[model samples]
Target: MPGQENMTDVTVIRGNVYERLSHVIDPEIGRSVTDLGMIVAIDVAPSHSTEGVRAPGRFDVTVHVELTVPGCPLTQTIQDRIDEAVASYPGLELVPHIEVGAMDADKLTGLVSSLKAERRENPFNKPGIKTRIFAIASGKGGVGKSSVSANLAATFSALGYDTAAIDADIYGFSLPGLFGVHSQPTNLNGMLMPVTAWGVKLISIGMFAGADRAILWRGPRLQRSLEQFLSDVWWGQPDVLLLDLAPGTGDMAISVAQALPNAELVVVTTPQPSASDVAVRSGLVALQVPLKVRGVVENMSYFDHAGERLRIFGEGGGTRVSDRLTDALGYDVPLLASLPLEPDIREVGESGRPAVLDSDGSLADTPLASSFTALARRLIG
Candidate 1:
């Protein structure tokens, strides 16, 4: 009986090991063999059960590494990694087996495409994970969009909600500095863990790259990189995942649409007519993805003059954009709140502190804080 149970345990462990091993990427296909469904079988038996070579506690594992295409060059890379991962487990020994298989090139490519599609589907709606996806976008830049995204994510953490933010701005990545985090993402069997900052979880190109450097990439290259970001990172299902979207509609936005079809959108804009008009375009662009625009936050709605309103950029831009979105989208787009222009807003972002946290006294009544808190409540609920 003891021997029988041990055999069952070994079999289970073999499957788990294979699952873990699948996370490893093949250099050629840019995807893991597991996602490709190239893993065929797993077998495990106590080394001692064999006629010779008795290692009592140790079990031997053999994993079938099937190639999607015949004569694939990266076969050995996959085998070596599987061998290493299985060997790391105590009470186990690994044996690698490589098999050559063939799928028509078109079928192989289709498999890769479907794997990418499955990931962007609502993981929240799926049974396995509790990750919430949030896309933060602005009508234009210089309206504190990135700063608000970083701080709101940080604030959610202070309130005890596990939060994460992604800088989807491809070319204009500013997330690393906003959180003051610096480090290349650590790769575990090819899966990278998200970096933590101020109690919030984050992923940004800035972490993997330099701020002063220009990322010169063609559309295909950009797609591949963003695609890898979603598939390769182990996000671990936080309460929410925020994205700092770039200022206009282009390839990056379309990629996000393809990947996170269920993603919710939050639009940010300043309280200026021209800004509002431009910001409206962002909402319209999101409509192309058909993403639901939850609400609107008016940044720099005004410059608070102590107890008086210093109507700097004029009022109602938030309301205007909200009304326009509601009309165009045929629903109520509540102008959530307005953020008063404050000099400290800049300082906090540069210092890696959110204005909502570093500033004192009734910030709730302040334009920016008011909008941020209200938006947070709406999105989270």
Candidate 2:
């Protein structure tokens, strides 16, 4: 019985074992066990005390884990890893029983929200400089938030303004792919450096995600990942910092509200009245965060079919949202820009270039560029 320990001693040792489990990293997110809040409970048999350990210590330990979804694909892996970790502990002779349970989506979202709220201060607000933070947001998915942000960043930099863009859509990140870059940010003394393209600095989790593999990403991890993007990135003090936020009033948007207090909210929407209606809600949600509603940019507003308007998505959406913002946001948020149904805007975005930089094309005559330039001046002033 070289390793046998007393019953009371074994119980005390189980408590120590639980504390050690905090060091295990979640395979998917690379965060230590404690951040996940995975451990639901711990049980040690009666008779426990580090100082009161007698000979012949009983061997017993149990660990409970809460999963985010049912039939968690990594259940076996997590169990085995925990078992191994426990086995390696000295004076612990038995593998602790691992209890697995799933947490509902709402509970997961709350945990993620709290994770983001923990980092309320703007980590990049360095001393002695002026920087404007702009969060490009939308009322719904597919409103072109990422595309608009990329063009704005590139356009700003092309005009000699030092600019950076953070892909704040942690789960639906589309910035890195938009730039045609596949490299991950390197950690330099813990500060991650952003990938540079078109004279604009960029950081995105997309660069770290593998395209061949996908998973159902849930709450706290999403917020923590976005937080890392803000806290760890070597974002230079620039004239402006653009954030490509995920669509809707979700955790990532809330993270923006908590982290970037000085940032202005720029909502993106379409011209359809229905689209405008939903877009208005996004601004209303921003008001909940106490975000200043800057203005709205209507993209793909309409298609010019031989002078007669096609009105594909519907009419007056941008105007509708603009008017609603005046009443709801308590400010006159003008219709900032109306990008007509120009394929070149999509082409440039797909090609990792902003439409504003497309020369010798119909896009050169489009209304997006002029509006963007004017918007920039208004922002700086």
Q: For this target, which candidate reaches the highest TM-score against the unseen true structure?
A: 1
Estimate candidate 1's alpha-carbon lDDT, on a 0 to 1 scale. 0.71
Model 2 weakest 10-residue run by lDDT? 358-367
- What digit string (tens of lDDT, one per residue) describes model 1 on residues 212-258? 68888757787676667776665556788888888877677776777
Regions of model 1 farther than 4 Å from truth: 1-129, 209-211, 358-371
Residue-wise lDDT of candidate 2 within 297-321, one digit each (tens)?
8877777777786777876778888
Itemize residue pairs with steric clashes in candidate 2. 5-56, 5-57, 6-56, 6-57, 6-58, 7-58, 8-47, 112-220, 271-317
**TM-score of every candidate relative to the true structure:** 0.64, 0.63
What residue pairs clash in candidate 1, if any at all?
139-279, 338-367, 339-367, 339-368, 340-367, 340-368
Residue 228 of candidate 1: its Cα lDDT? 71
Query: Which ranges in model 2 have alpha carbons more than 4 Å from their true place?
Result: 1-121, 126-129, 209-212, 215-219, 305-310, 359-366
Model 1: lDDT of residue 38:
72
